[model samples]
Each structure stands twice: as structure tokens, then as C-alpha cells.
Target: MSTATAEPAGRPEGAEDAQGAERAEGAEGTGPIRFGVVGTGWRSEFFARLARGLPDRLELAGVVTRSAERAARVRREWGVPAFLSVAELLAAEPEFVIPSVPWEVTPEVTGELVAAGVPVLAETPPAPDAAGLRALWEQVGASGLVQVAEQYPLMPGHAARIALVREGVIGTPTSVQVSSTHMYHAVSLIRHTLGVGFEPVTVTARAFTAPLADPLSPKGWSDDLTPKDARTTLALLDFGGGRSALYDFTDNQWWNPLRSRRMVIRGSLGEIVDETVVRMADPRTPYETPLVRRRTGLDLNLEGSEVRHITFDGRVVWRNDHTGAHFSEDDLAVVELLCRTGAWARGAAPEPYPLAQGCQDHLIALAVEESARTGEAVATGDEPWSA
Candidate 1:
């Protein structure tokens, strides 16, 4: 293990101060929170972009990779030091460590970091299995350090849509329909928007083995399986407030390619549909209204408009001029939230998307999978799984 100390790089534009004990003592006003990242995969690049965007709030202290070649590559590409061991990386005393490694390695790697009293902003599915997830939660609890990161529900347009629903722009939300093929992704968004520990009254799932092809995968993936290509699941979730949600997952959706992953919500007064563009209903006129489709910048035209015919009310309005990736915007929102709320506050109150929320989403995902396997409705327990 090799340890080296580097001077703090000034805070990135719009960076917020840390909210930890050190900040209360007036340490945050001085510099950015040193952040050491573990893993150099695709997700790392996203975080790197975030770091670049918020240099004031976060500093790239170093990167840790298992292999010398990868470490060298990251150091050269990002212009930051790299370490081969966690201990070596920790020696620099980064206030936060982000683990973007595979789900299988999350339990072990994050467990060690939490035990060392290092806060973590880990990637999704902190563990591959329920047991691993539980163990990670336990370790985080014992360590007295915070572990939190939620990307799905916090995604840019989705978060804004959620706020709109909460504000009653869509009237009383009676039911929600989410169409997605990624089981974990859908569950995370559902759990985040509607609190955790929601029970499903009924669930019907159809599984078909299909070939999978993912160019990003190590095997260069494809979705052509021998038996079936996908599993479609429909779940009826009861939240006890006269609120219910219909969740759908289909492995094969030809139109999916045209739209960046989509989600639609229906309420008594109105409905919101998000695909390439985000469309909403006008609160006062009962007509469809168009919200800003994507993020603020990029190439999307901000002045174009489109109209769609819907069954419920009047024509749905959509805007084609919006530019930017909703996902990237969501990522920036989390960063902005972190800065505004201060970095050190524990749990969801201060963070909005806390470790507990992430854990809850994980549990719900497990229940979804379990319900699919057992062919029975799975009920969520009351335990608040936080770290």
C-alpha cells in the first residue's frame, strides 16, 4: 500500500460545504471534501464528470484499483493519483469514498470501508443477494458511518415529475404504471417515490428465457435466450392511502430502443408520461401541458412543441426542444442536493435520498424477485433498513 497527501483542489462551481461535525466546527468553509473513488469502470466516469461539475464541493483525492494497469490508466486519464489497495487510498484521509464496483464485490469492499469509519456513496445493489444486503447494512450500522447513494428515483426528469405529483399537479395520485425491463431499476424508482416497505396485494409474472446481448457487458451481451427472451411481470402494489401502483416489466419491447428508459404515472386529475419527452396535464384547464422535457443544456431545442391524443382527458402536450440527458441531470441533482444540505447529514431527511431509502429499494427489489419465483404476493416488512 502506498499513501500520499495532496493539497485540496478548490471547490468546483456551485459546490456546497460539508455538513459533518467538521463543518459544524467551521472546517467546510475552507476547501472541498476530498473524495477517493474505488473502481474505474463506466460508473466511475459518470462520477468523474460529477466531480468535474462540483469541484468546489468534492475533490478527487485519488482512485483505487486492484490492478496496476487499471490504476495507471485512471491516473493518466484523470490526472489524479491511484492506489492499489484500500488502505493505501485511505492513508490520504478522504472524507468520502465512492465504490462503483460490481454488485458482487459491494458487500466485502463497502463492509471494510464502513468498518473503517469511512462514509460511502456506493453504487446500486450494494449486495448481490438479500443476505449480502443485510450483512452490509449491519456492518454500516456498526461502523457508525453513513452509506447512501440513490440514482434511479433521483434521475433528473423523474425527480421533477415526482415533485410535481407531490405538489398535486396531477391531483390525487391513485395509481402509477411503470413499464420497464430492468427489475431493479423499476423497483428503485417505485420505492424512492412512494416510501419503502410497500406490500403487493397480487403479482403475476411470466418468464421466458431469451438471448441477451449487451455490448457493454464483458461477454458482449445479447437478449436471445433459448427458452424465452424476457420475463414480463405485473404487480399490484397497495400503499394503504388509497394509493396503488401498477408495475410492468417486459424483456421485449421494440419501442424501448427509441426512448431512453420510460415511466408513466396516472392520477385522478391528470397524468404524466415521460419518454423522449416529458408530458403532463394542465392543472387548471384540464388540458395536457408540456413540462421541460430534458435538462437545461446540450443540443435539445428548448422551444419546440408536440401534441398527443390521450384517452382520459384532452390532447397531451410534449416539448421536443429540451436538451440534455435526464439521467445526467438526475446525477447533478443529487450532487446539488448534497451541497445544499451539507455533506455530513445522516439518513434521508437531510439527503432526501439516504442510505435507508436505498436499502428499502433493495429490499423491495428482493421481494419482487421473490414474488416472481414463488408465484405469490410478497408483503414488505416494517423494518427501516438504514445505515
Candidate 2:
């Protein structure tokens, strides 16, 4: 992987250098980048925090919400103006606008922003289905003002894992196993680690009801107890080059309070078993001795004993601690990169994970769903994984 050093200390918040700062300020030194946000919901809080933490790099110019009450609340909370209409938001001339609305509402709102040539950092899964995502992609491709806000791969722990993989610590990563109850979450991780290049070679799935009630279901949405409602899907993803990944997802796991999401990667040299515990067992040495351990918020260690163990604080592992909440240090590393590179803005060229990458992941997910429904092997095209 290419190595790029982060901007040194004393550099302006969003600029790479003095000249970049001048350009960012204005054509000849104007001001900071102004951001308008759409949707006032749980998701918006992440952006709110980012804006708050980096005032010079990101400024929350205004916000748009459907209800006046919610808009007023967000305005008071963030100390920024709020608008009920997209036109009102566009009039503010924000350099970028982040839409945190649901899939159903994203298309229309994104279209409005693209139509006005306003840059956008829209939330995922960009649309409800592939067609809608394609339409949004086309519009953004033509208008040059959209960047999908899929934050999963950039979330701290995952980002750290990606870095470790790139560093060859695992040695020729040949396969990965990911388990999560939510299909979307599982797919996001798969895509992040394997990239868009992974192809679904086979799928085996079974559905069963656990006879448990779902608290999140609305009154009318809970009518049926079909197996599909509580199911498990296992897929074999072939990335070619003898590399493969096994994906396991189970809705029933959600009902089990003790269950937790887990990901394991296997390679020729060693393996990373879990984010909470970093375990490396060299093939040459005994698995018991000379183990390496690195937990979150601690230094890495090379131990002489077999089966070295490292325990991370429950709060740090859960991502609920204030210091480790929402994003990790690794995640902040990527965010800092985005701020410095200005990749979050509309019309910017594609970065490591481009807009098309999201579309590809969606299509692969659709293929997985199809394979599971038909109980047959599904082969994907080369386009999905191509950068």
C-alpha cells in the first residue's frame, strides 16, 4: 500500500499547507468550509460531533429537518440555523450538505441537492434497492456533487484491522469469517475487507422462528412469524487467487443477549481472531509459546509463553466509552485524512473507496440474497470489485 504521512502539527485545520489554506479560505483567501446538514436523527449526531470537534475544518452552517419541532431542537443543540426546505438550505451556499434521511427519502433529497450543484455526503445504503442506487449514482456522476456516507469501514476498530492486514502481519490473507445478525452490517464488513472483488460462489441458508418477540418491530409490521423473519445465511465468497470468505448471519442471534458480533481472518502466517483480542500463532512455533497480543488502547506485546491473552476493558471493547465511543483512534485517522484531502466534498475525484464501490457492494449483496433465495450458486462479474 502507498504510504502517505499525515499533515504535521500547526497546519491549519483543513489545509495541507499555507497555499492550500489560502485556496480553502477562498479563491484568494475567503473562509472555512461551510456545511449544511439534512435530517435530524440519531445518525446526525456523528456528524455533529465531527463538526464540533473540528470547527476550523468543518462548520455546521445550517440543518434541515421535516418537523419544525425537531429542526428547532437540532438548531438549539448545535447552535446553527435550521431550515425546513431544501431551497432554504441551498440558499445558504453551503460547500457541502449531509443528508441523514432514510432510504426512501434520500433519493428525492439527493436529487434536489445534485440539481442545484450542491455537494452532498448522503447516508447509506444510498437507496432502497439497486435501481434507485444506480439512479442516484448517475445523477451524481453527471452533477459531480455526491459522496455516499458509508462509515462502516472507517469505524475505528475495523480501520485498524484493515491497516494490520495491509502491513502483512497476517501474511497472505486467504480467507475471512464474518458473523453478524444484520445483513447490511455483515455485507459492509465483507466489502471493506475483501473489497468489491469478492464473488459469491455458493450460498446455503435456513430460516427459523425462535418464538421471540422483536421490540423494534412496529405494531403492524409484526404480523408474521415466518422463518425468513428469523433466519441464518451462510455464504461462500470466492475472491479468486485461492482466497475465500465465509459469511454467517443469523437474526436469531439478536434475541440472545449474550451474543456478540465477531470476525476472524485466517492467513498463511498467522490469524487475527477478534478485535477485542489480537492473537497471533505462528505456524513455525508452537501455538502456546511466543504469542503476540495487542488489545485496544495498549501497546503490542510479543510473549514467550504459549497462548498469551490480552483483555480489553469492556467499555473500550463495546465502543460505548466516551473516549472510544462511536469512532476509534483508527477511525479518527481516516476522518483526519478525509478532512485534509477534501474527499468528503462533491465533485472531488474518487478516493480509496469510491462512490461506485458502494454500488458494487449493494449489487453483491443483492446477488447473495438471490443465491440464498434460489439455493443455487451465483457468480458475480468482475466489475463489482474493480476499483
Candidate 3:
């Protein structure tokens, strides 16, 4: 595994750095990397909130809203310039713009920015439907300036898993079972964990619905005994060479604690069940230890707390830019995405999540849904962007 760039610090993949690398963010640093957002919607708030939360590492250069009224509200809340169009947002000279609009309109917004030569860190599912996928790919696929924010694999826990898998600690990772996220995001983790690059695969899926108590959501818990039909999908992706993945997810799987968020990685020597790893310590020795997370500012501490890093057996596998800052794993992942994008735009790092990878993830995800709907195996066909 190569070192994937993280921010304020570069997070190289695989175990600890040979040089005993430590976080190098100065006790102080420059103003955060300046970037802009193109929408004022819910998804776009992550970008704005990240910049606002990490003042030392990011700066919200400007925002492109749909109307002057929304722009005014945004300006008051974020204390940053807000524009009604991309042209106006470009005037501030941001390093890039994230087209965080609806899936239906994302292509147009992204195409507009790409035409203007403004780099983009696009939102997920770059396009909504198959036609849109092909059209969007042909339009900006060759631009080399767009990187999608497929941040799941970069999430702290997943990053630790990948880093450990890369070191052969599990001995040739063979299979992955992901129930944490849906389709594309799940496929991303499966392919990454198996070390399979944009490879073709056969997918068989089935969908079943059952009457279950409606679980609580951010919107609020449902009234007790209110039964809602819940869809459960199970998908099998065979990548050949006996490398495969099983994706199990229920509707709103992300929010359903009753479903039990989990991952199982099987290897030649053993397997990993969530935080615990049962693998060979040596030829004759078997060892297991829970992945330990070191955090700061617990309980009665006034210094504030944040996830520091995850480790297995005392060896740090993944560390963040802000070691003690207030951030959840997902928050840290998104911050790293923005920072890495800024670095890529400035030629300080490689494209973080390339266009091809994002396209492939979505294409596979589509196959999952199709397979589930038709009650048959779906062969993942080559798309225009298949490399």
C-alpha cells in the first residue's frame, strides 16, 4: 500500500513510518487552505462546517448558493462571502469548488465548473442514473481535475483496517463482509480490503422485506408498534481467484443499531471480527488483540477530546492531522479529504480519489440494486469509464 496523503500531515499507508514519524503540525501554522462550496444544502454543510471547525487547516473561501437570499443567510451564519453563481464564486480565486448539489443537478454544476477550469471535489454518486453516469464521464472524465469525496474508506476505523490488511498482518486478505454502508461505499471497502483494483466481477443479489418495528432516526423514533416494511439486501461479488465479498445491508442500515454495524475480514491464517483479530503470531503461534483507540480529554478534562489514532498491539496504524482536536472519525475523514484535495490542487499530492475509482464504485453499486430488483445475478458490465 502506498502512502495516501492526509492533511497538515501526510498519512502514508501501511504500518508505522520507518523513521518513527510523529505529527508535525506546528503548535501553529498558516491560515487554512482556502476552498469554496457550490451549494448551501445539507450535504454541503459538511464542507463549510469543517472549514469553520478547523480554522487552522481550512478556510471557507466562498459559497455559491442558488439565490441571493440563501447567500445572505449563509454569509451571516458562516461569516464568509456567498455568491449566487459559480462565476461570482470564482472571483474569490478558491483552489477548488465542491459541487454539493442534488444528484439530479450535480452533473450540470460540475460541468459548469469544469468548463471554467475550476477544480472540483465532487459529491458522491457523481451522477444519478445510468444515462447521467455515461454523460458525466464523457464530459469531464478526462479533465484530471475532479476528485470525488468517497470518504468511507478513509474513515478512521476503516483506514486502520486497510492499513493493517496492507501489512499482510492477516495474510492475504481473501474475503470481506460489510454491513455498515450501502452499495458504492460498501463496494469501495470490499475492493480495497481485497486489494482488487477496478476488476470485473459477477454479482448475485436478493432483496427481502419484513415487517419490523420502525427504528429511530435523526428525524426521531417511530411510535412503538408502528410496523414498516424494511428491505434487506444481500449481495455477493465474486472477483475471481477465490477473492470475494458479501454486502449485507438494510434500508437505513447506517442508522439502525439493531442491525448491528459490523465487518468480517477472512484471511489465509485467520479472520477479523470488528475490533478483534485472530491471526497467527508466528508459524506456530496464534495471537489476538483488540484494536485499541487512544483518545484525549476524557471525563473531567477541560482540554477537549478527539480521536488520536487507532493501534493494534501498541503499533499505531492510523493518525490524524489534529491529534487532540474535537472531531469524530467521520469528521476527521472529511477534513482529510478537503485538505488532500487542496494539496492535490496545489501539486503537493496525487489525486486523492480519482475519477475512475469513483465511477467504478457507483457502477458496481448500480449492479447491486439491479441484482436485488430483478432477483437474478447481475454481471457488472464495462462502462465508458472502465479502465
Candidate 4:
């Protein structure tokens, strides 16, 4: 596409300035992790706004747009320096940079940033398709400086579920049913929940269509009763050794609120559905309990609330460091990813999500789509990054 200067006018109110955004929620005195963004698109705003709100943990060193006019707008609106190119942006000495460009051009932008020894945290898919993903990996996967911004596994509820799985709450998790996001994102969640790497897999899928009305959204929905064709695609991922996963997704499921998001993680001893769990509690007794969430700002509680943590019975499972950040689940998860990338870049944490894993997720997702379209089973384990 042409050099589209994605407007920051649509950015959420109060996220314009770090000091003024979320005073109640901004992280305090942990030292800011500096980074810049390489695009002015919707994805770029996420990082910029997050840094604006939580200056203690993140700093928006600068942002790069395609032209001087767009750069001027960025500077006037977000108060962070703006650059006409990646080279100009890096001159500000950001610890790392996040490439929030469109899918088709992400690899090019990423490669340019990498050549300057700038660490990168890339957006989803990393590249457009399997070939692009593989090519990108072959070029930078060995450098240990790039991390994909795949944060589904780190979402509070999802993270809690993963923690429970690792604790053997459901015994050995053999199957996972995820119907949240779509394509590579859903694949990433399934792989993380099932604790599988780039294993050989066989994928089979089918797409179904139906007319349905979407009722709600983050900004509420329309009262129009007109129906739209909702394509529901179901894919099965077989990870050998008695491990498999079912990925179910409906059209617009990512943003439509009428469709309730759900997951069913089944193991040998029991299973977890949403917030409740049914599993063996002891040698002779089977018990059932709910995953309770502690919130500070609802009901009769006058406190302006936020998610404090998630728990099973009384034990805390996932704690929310951004307790009052006023961020959504996805936003909260992304903030964690950014900080994790910062740590890895600074030699303080383990590799977050390697480029190969992101590629594998997309490669199998492509196979699922290919199989669904042709009504055949697609075999894996032949890719260069296959673990």
C-alpha cells in the first residue's frame, strides 16, 4: 500500500501522555525500559499508549513514520520524538525497537532494524505466510535478538490455566480445546497449553457457514437485525503420543462479544472449563472447584477495582502487576510481552518466544487452512524449523 499515515486521533483518550494517562495504574520506580516503534498503525499505538500509561516499566523513546508530516503529527500528539525512518529513530538510543508495520512489510522493516543491532519485538504472524515466516527465521532466528509479540498464553485467565496444567492439576494434559482467537494465534495458545514444541503434526479441518447476528462489542453494537454469514472453522491438531488439540473459531470471533470465548483443557485425571475444574484432589477423592478471580472495583465494593489476581480455591495462581492499569486482557498481556522482551534484551530473562515457534504456529495454521479447503489431511514435520 501507499505510505499510509495511520492517525493517532483514534487512540483512546488519556493514553496521549505518559504522565497524564493512568496515574493510578502507572508502574512506580522500577526504571523505564526504553524502546521505539517503527510504524504509526493501530498496533503501534498499543505500545505507545502502554508506555504512556506505565512510564515506570516502559518508555516511548520515539516512533518512526514514513514522512515528515506524519512524524510531526506523532510528536505533537504523543509527545514522543518522531522520526522519518528507522535509522533516525535508532539515533535516539532506544534499548530495542518494536516493528508494528503491516504484515507484508514487517520482515523488511524487521531486517532493517536488526542490521543496526536493534533488538526487535515483532507483531503477530511475524510475516505473511509460511514461506515468509521461514525466510525471516533463517535470516534472524539464530541471532537471538527477535521475539514475536504473541501474548495469548500470558493473558491472565489463560496464564492461570497454563500454571494449573504445569502443576499437574489435571494430570498430564493430553488435549486442549481453544476457541478464542484465530489462525496462528489460536495455534500458539494450543501449543503452549499442551506444552508441545515444534513437533510433527497432522492437521484436519472443516469450515461451516451459518447466518447469525452479532449483538455486542467493546463500544456496544447495533440494533440492526440483519443476519450475516458466520464462517465457523474447526481444526484438529494431532501432536502424536496421545496429544491433540481442537481449534474452533467463528467469523469475527476476535471482536464480536455475542460469541462467548471458552476453553476446555482435558487431562488424564480431570478437566478445566472456563473457571471451574473437575479433577482428582487426592488418592481416593475427586473434587470440583472454581477458579476465583479477585477484583477490586465491582458490586457493593466502592473501591475502583481492577483484576488483582486469579486463584483456585484460596491459592493465588496468576497475579496482576498492573492491577489498576485499566487495560484489557489483551493489553495487559502485551505489556508483559514488552517487558519480557526488554529483560531478554538486557540479559536478565530467558528467551521469551523465539522466532521459530512463531513460524511453526503459522506454518501449521497454513496447513490447517490448506487441508480445510481441499478436504484432506495435511502432514507436517518437514519444515526446516520442525523440532
Candidate 5:
């Protein structure tokens, strides 16, 4: 994985250097990259909030909402021009546009934007189903203007682990177990940790259901504490050549307070379990260390409450560039995706997360679901984007 331009100090070894990278920021020397939003839903607001929070790096030029009332509310709340159509949003001349609409509508909107020759940072699972994914790929896969907003790899903990894996701290990752986010997001993490690309996978999965108390959601906590039956899906993805990933996910794990995210990346020399790493440092002895995070605003630190950097065995693996903004782990990941997308759009860096990669992630995720539903293994062969 190539590092983006304008990376902070303490980047891992073998990562790309920012010094020789081109500076093609549109009309502004190192100024914020201008972008537009094409929805008024919960996820779309993430982009708007990021633009407002990091004014020095991002600027929201306009937005496109479905209704006049929603457009008016967005304009009043976000203080950006809200339009009714993508064409009107394009008139703002944003360098790129983000489509955060529903699953079924995403590919259509993305195709429309691609037809206009505009760069797009689409939301996760660019299409709803396998057929939709195939159709969307046939339409826009050839166009290099589409990049998916797959930000899980950009999360601080995952970023740190990916760095260590790339630095050979774990020596050729063989398998990964992810009990974190669902579907494509987890697959993305698995691929990054294992360093596999476009490999065919055979997935075997099963789902179990149990009653659990779930009072939290995207809308916040509810008064009802009733226990509801929740489904947990477990999958084994065999990526061939002794590479595999274990995928585990529960319903509403993203916002449930009771469930915690966990990961284990196993390699020949060592393995990383959550934050702790156990590896052979020398032929005679084994070394165990924790990935420590430098978080400010603990007791007497005046630097505010935010993660500064992550260190493993006295070396910085990941450093936060937007430290003072006080973002959560997910927020940090999304912001990093936005920054990298900006660089890629301006030709300063490689495409952050291309369409094919996103397509593959979703294709595998869909296979996981199919295997779970059918109680049989599903083999995901090459698709149009596999090339």
C-alpha cells in the first residue's frame, strides 16, 4: 500500500516519501480540496462534518439532496449551497463528488457522475447485489474516475498493524481473524493485513441467532431495554496459498455498546492480537509488546483529547495528521480517506481505493452471505474487475 502525500512524521519503512510527490492542489497551494456531496442522509453528513471540522484540508462546495425541504435544511445546517440535481452540484466545479445515497441507487448515481467525466468517491458497497456490481463495473470500471470510500484500512489501529505487517514485523502474514465491522469492511481489513490482491476465495460460513439486549443505534440510546434475537455470522475465507481469513460479525455491532471489535493477524514469525503483539525477536527468545497509543488530555496534558500516534516497540507506526480535530477512530479513518482521495484526484498520489478493490471486497462479502444462507461453501471466482 502506498502512503499518501503530506503524511506526518514517523511513517513506516518502505512507505512512499512525500517529498518528491507532485503538488497539484487545484488553484490553492496546499489549501483545502473542494468537494461536493450528493445526499442528505446520515452517512452523507459525515463528509459535511469532516469538511467543516478540517477546513484547512477540505472544503464543501455544494450538496445535492432529494427534496427541496431537505436541501433547505442542509443549506441552513451545513452553510453550503444545496442543489436539487447532480448537474447543479457539478456547476460548483468541485474537484470531486461523494455519493452517499442508498445501496440500490448508488450505482446509478455513480454512473451518472462518471458519464460527466467527474471524479467520484462513492460510499461502501458501490452496488447492492452481485448483478448490480457486475453491471456497474461494466459501465465505470474502465473509467479511472471512481474511487470507493473504503476507510477501514485507514483506521488508526488497522493502519498501525498494516504498517507493522509491511515492515515485516510479523513476517509474511498467513491468516487474519476479524470480529470487527461487517461484510466488505472486514474483508478489506483482512486483505490489507494478509497483503493479498485479487485472489480467488472459497468461503464457508454459518449463522447463529441469540437474544441480546440492544438499546443503542445510530439514532442513539433508546429507553426500551428489551432483548431481541440477534444473528451472528462466522465465515472462513480461503484465499489459497496458505492464506485465509476468519470473518465474524454480529447484527448492529457497529453501534452496539456491548460488543467490541477485535482482530488477530497471524504470520510466520509472530501474530498481532488486538493491540498486543507476540513475535520472535531473536532465535533464542520471544518478544511480547503492546501497541501503545499516545493520547493527549489524560491528566495534565494540555494538548486536548485526541490520539497523537501509535507506537510499537518504541517505533511510530501510525501518526495522526489531524490531531487537534478530536476525531473518533472511524472519523479519523474517513478523514484520511478524504485526504487521500483529494491527492489521487489531483494526480499527486495513486488512487486511494480503486473500484475493482471495492468490487472484490463486496463480491467476497456477498459470497460469505450466500454460504451462510445455504450451509455450503461458496467459491468466488474472478469477475470483470478482477483484471
Candidate 6:
């Protein structure tokens, strides 16, 4: 294996200048944590963009893409070395490698990296299906070098809610209603807020078809002016012990403006619906408050329209650690995962998200799909990783 150092050749086009780069890189005084990526796909670019945004905390050491044309594009666009193999990428000595390839390819690449004794932060799902998940778990589940990049719980809004729930502000959470993202992402959020571990869940789901305007998607706004039939799947997850979750998802909900992202966490003493918190302060008194966000650059105060922190009951529940980075809420979560993975890889912090958690999340998600199709309830039993 090649052990040659792969360093940045020069600053890429549109990158910040020397003084600005230095200022951002030196902000934390520990230098940027260098990491490598093993794919150059669309999802991988999110990592590259976040590294550029949060220069003080992250640095892209190299990228591995099989296609020479894509590799050249990555080198030109990212201003980082592009290699053809994991061995070459590891030669750069990145603290960890993010396998952001396709779902089917993720487990194989992750196994390769783990076998090489390098820490890895794998993309979501980790495998394509249940069998794939089991096989992948059998391969690298006990390596203790794998962390999945599950960023949903790390988002500022969700993080704040989770903090409140953990602090007994909501008593013991009994159920959660998630209408935001879908599949494993939705499952991750539900499991996280309810604080449920590998407990077996009985999922009852069904699909409904309805007409809705399809204006927006991940690509962009569609010019076709027509209302199309959209699929909406709703499921009830029973975690036993009187804990449950209601999973609701509509097609294109992530980008469609008509369907807003929503969540509800119900506890013994109170419940949280989106940004509003309603709880019983005492035996007969009820309290209500909005989780206000300190966003800058609204009218005249020019801090540049970024989220500063989230507050509840006059106390800060979630603070933007990358305040000056000008990142969106989703970007904030991704960048936080990258930094936390880097810290764990270097033994400076605990594992951010373990592979077993991802496996369980996906397993439950698959059951959701199955129950929706078969029109019957599905139960997920213990898996190898569930232990």
C-alpha cells in the first residue's frame, strides 16, 4: 500500500484567501482535524462543503473516486488530493474515512476500511436491506471502529427538544409523532426522543394515495403545473412498556412546501408540538412557552441571518457552536457529526453513533415498509446487532 502523503496542492477556486483561511483555521487553536472521503457522489459533497465552511474544526485530507474524470473534478473543485483506492487515501493519514458511497457499496467499503484498522464514519442505513444489514453486521459489528453518520438527532431543534426531555421537563416520554423525514431518518428521530434502545417493536402501517401538487423535489422546483397522486404512509410503532410512536410520511415532504415538517413528543407531564412546549407546572397550573431562536441579521443587526442559539424558558437549550459558519440547520447537524466523529476517531471523545444503532434503525424502517405493503402488522425480533 502506498504511504505517500497526499497534501493540498493549492487553494481551489472561490476558496477564501490566506488571511481569512488562517483566521478560520486558528479559531479553535487545536488545528483542523484532517479526514478523508471515499466517494465523490452528491452526498459526499456535503462533507466537502461542511469542511470548507467549518475550517477550524474539519479538513478534507483526500478523496477516493474510481472514475478518473470524477477524480479530476474533485481535485479541481475541492482543492484536495484525489486518489484511486482506499490504500492511497489512507496514505494521507486522515483521522477517519467517511464512506459516502451508494447504499449497497457502503458496507463493502466500510468493511475494507475497518479491516485496515482505520476508523470510519459510514453513511446512513449502512446497507441496502435487512439481509444486507445482517451480513454487514456480521462482518464488522464487533470491530468497534465503525460509527454511522446519523445526523437527525443532532439537528438544533431536535437536540433542544431532546435536552428538555432528558432534563425531566417533559417527565418520562411515552410516545412520539414524527411527520418530517422518512425511513431510517425518521426512525432515528423517534427512537432518539423516546430514548428507546434495541427493544423489539411491533409496527402496524398502511399506505394511502391522495392528490397533491408536486412542485418541489431534491432537484429543484418543477415547472409542470399538475396535481399528482402522492403516497402517504402512516405507521404505529409500539415499543412496549406503554411507549409508542406514530410515524407519518408523505412523498416529497422534505421539499414540498405544502407539507410542513412536524413532530410531537408526549410525556406524562407535558407534550412538545414543534416549537411550542405545553406542560403542567403544578397540580392545577398549566404552562406554555415557545422555543425561541436567537437568529441574527433580521432587520439591522448584521450578524448575517444565521441561527445563534435556541432558548426555552429564558435558558439556552441549544447553542450554535459554529456561529459564524453561516450553515443551514441540516448542515449544522452534518458538520457536528463530522467533528464528533473526528474527535472519537482520535480518542478525544466517545463514539458519536454506533453501527448497531444504525442497523436497528434500518431494520425497523424496513418493517415499516413491509407492513405498509402487506397490510398487516410486522414485528422485528432480535438481530445479531440488537445485543
Q: Quote the lDDT for 191 in model 3.
A: 79
Candidate 2 colliding pairs: 25-30, 25-31, 26-30, 196-385, 197-385, 288-306, 288-307, 289-305, 289-306
> Per-residue lDDT for 171 in model 4?
88
Global local distance difference test of model 1: 0.56
lDDT of 4 by residue, 1-387 (tens): 000110101122222222122222433424788998999987787788999878878899999998889888888888889998788888898877888888998899888887777778888788998779879988876565677888887888888888888788898999999998899888887887788876789999999999988765455677765778889989999999999999899988877867879999999989999898998757898889999978876889865656777878798888777655667767878888878767666655445676777788888889889988999999877666553
Per-candidate count of clashing residue pairs (backbone under 3 Å): 26, 9, 1, 3, 0, 0
Candidate 5 Cα lDDT to native: 0.85
**Which 10 successive residues of model 1 have the least lDDT summed?**
1-10
By TM-score, who's the top model here?
5
Candidate numbers, best TM-score first, in rank order: 5, 6, 3, 4, 1, 2
**Candidate 3, clashing residue pairs?**
3-12
Candidate 2: tens digits of C-alpha lDDT, residues 1-387: 112211111111232323223334443223455777788876676667776765655666788887999888877887778889888988887766777888788888888887876666666666777678667776664443555655555444555455555556667677778875455455666655643243444444433344444433422345444433455677877766777778777665644433466788776666767653333545445342112333343345433212112223222211211222334443354344344335334223223333455555666666677778887777766442232
lDDT of 6 by residue, 195-276 (tens): 8888899999999999999888888989875989999999999999999999999998999998999999999989999999
* Candidate 2, residue 182: lDDT: 52
lDDT of 5 by residue, 82-146 (tens): 99999999999888899999999999999999898888899989999999999999998877788
> TM-score: which is higher, 3 or 6?
6
Q: How far is 66's C-alpha from truth in model 4 (Å)?
A: 0.6
Question: What TM-score, computed on C-alpha atoms, does each candidate reach?
Answer: 0.71, 0.69, 0.90, 0.89, 0.93, 0.92
lDDT of 1 by residue, 102-180 (tens): 8899777787787776767777766777677667766664443544555445444555566566656666666666775
Model 1 Cα shift for residue 333 (angstroms): 4.8
* lDDT (C-alpha) at residue 317 in model 2: 19
The local distance difference test score of each candidate is: 0.56, 0.56, 0.78, 0.78, 0.85, 0.84
Better TM-score candidate (1, 2): 1
| C-alpha-based local distance difference test score of model 4 | 0.78
Give RMSD (Å) of candidate 6 vs. truth. 9.2
